[model samples]
Target: MPSALLPIIAWDYQFAPNAQKSRNYLYITHTPFKICEQPFLLPRPALLSLGITYRRVPVLSIGKDVFCDNASFLDAMQELLEREGEGRALKRGGADRAFEAWGYRSFWVALASVPAGLVSKELGEDRRELFRRF
Candidate 1:
């Protein structure tokens, strides 16, 4: 079994959706994982140590395999669940395909239309700076 560590920040509009989705999947499947609430506005050196240069939230660490984005995280989770037989339920509801589309394809496409100025306005200085850099 692999361990997933999710860094959750409750107030982040951009991040909360994916984090909540991941958390829900874990709870429904009864996957044992750790959730740590951290400041999204600050520099996360721990993620950097894991070779995640983007320094974003919703990172899933399975041993040495670190998934940095929602798409990768969900993809890996689906693979793991398939091996555990829980994936059948996901397939039955079309959740497996749905989430993959939402996380990997649709999310970014939708987010692309969101004004960067609006996002910058919502973010604190530290996060705004980091977002610009990334």
Candidate 2:
């Protein structure tokens, strides 16, 4: 079974770093997939339909199975690669974890540094509501 025949869907906000990370990982592994770009605000109907209430981007859906969060997403991708006999193409370890943590911290810092004037009021309110629990 060729990888392209499988339905791999990645859901994320437009220009999201997490989504970009997923794309890079897939590209490096020669995985063929599609991305469903979403809006920054709420009402993500596709994700809601999948029963994913978590407010985050880079959600990966392979067939009926969905992998949310970076860890699970990477694990699933690795599994897929292994199943396809491409296991040796990429290796995972503590370095990946450290990079993920650093990337997330940097992402937050960059987001925080964005000028208020450059961001719309609705986006600001949306993010505040979404990340209120954090």
Candidate 3:
């Protein structure tokens, strides 16, 4: 009999591509997890019901375990990989990985720093929505 997967969920996250790489790996490895998605800047009443009170985005919860920070979350993932044979190859570590992570972290910051005009006059909703649909 297979081990029953401990209901895994990514709490309230909207990450750019590189962070998505880590997520993509979980999917590729066939790890059992669920996405408890929440809208940005909103109270995650769903996560709160699970005993998480950190008030930060992008957490992981399994059984009684809840991880709040990204570093700790990745470290927990590393532990899971050791048991599951996901290894270092899958993780983009070292300088290149650091750069990509930096890029991922900075993406939203850059987007936010952009003038409001860019969001409206520059990238119209129709054009953005069209890109988003794909």
Candidate 4:
């Protein structure tokens, strides 16, 4: 069985937002797989072993096939579950479809489109300052 690796990192920061999404997909689809909570920093030997170039969390592994990142991972999951006609969430009118449809637009909008006043109000000055630096 393939294992979904989630890096145990802070959610508020921008780098590894895919862990939560990947975790939710696995749960919703009831995919039988192992969860490997890994460190937030340091190179992941597991990922390197799989020959996945992107050193990021939420990598899905099935034998030699490694789906790196949320988009690819979710797509792989959809294919795997849908091919057998299992995992209704990957079927028509599913939440997974809706979520993938939205993609990163909502995230970027939430961060970028707002006025400085609005962003500061919503995220607090300190967090907004950090984001600004990034």
The CA lDDT at 30 in model 3 is: 65
Give stretches of model 1 more than 4 Å off.
1-15, 86-89, 92-124, 127-134
Expressed as tens digits, the lDDT of each residue in 18-105 for candidate 1 is 6777777667766776655545555556655655566556766655566666667667776766876645325546575676675657
Instruction: Return the top candidate by TM-score.
Output: 2
Error of 4 at 31 (Å): 0.8
lDDT of 2: 0.75
Report the candidate with higher TM-score, 3 versus 4.
3
| lDDT (10s digit) by residue, model 3, range 8-31 | 677656563433654665576566
TM-score of 1: 0.58
Badly placed stretches (over 4 Å) of model 4 are 1-16, 49-53, 87-89, 92-134
Top of the candidates by lDDT: 2
Over all chains combined, what TM-score does candidate 2 have?
A: 0.81
TM-score versus the correct structure, for each prediction: 0.58, 0.81, 0.60, 0.54
Query: Relative to the unseen true structure, what is the C-alpha lDDT of residue 32 in candidate 4, on a scale of 0 to 100?
Result: 58
Quote the positional error of residue 26 for candidate 4 in Å: 1.1
- Regarding lDDT, does 1 or 2 come out ahead? 2
Kindly give the stretch of ten consecutive residues in candidate 2 with the minimal lDDT sum: 125-134
User: What's the C-alpha lDDT at position 6 in model 4?
Assistant: 25
The sequence of per-residue lDDT tens digits that candidate 4 reaches over residues 25-108 is 777776655666555543556555546546446666654565656667667667666765644446555575577668766777
Q: What are the lDDT scores of the predictions, listed in order?
A: 0.58, 0.75, 0.58, 0.56
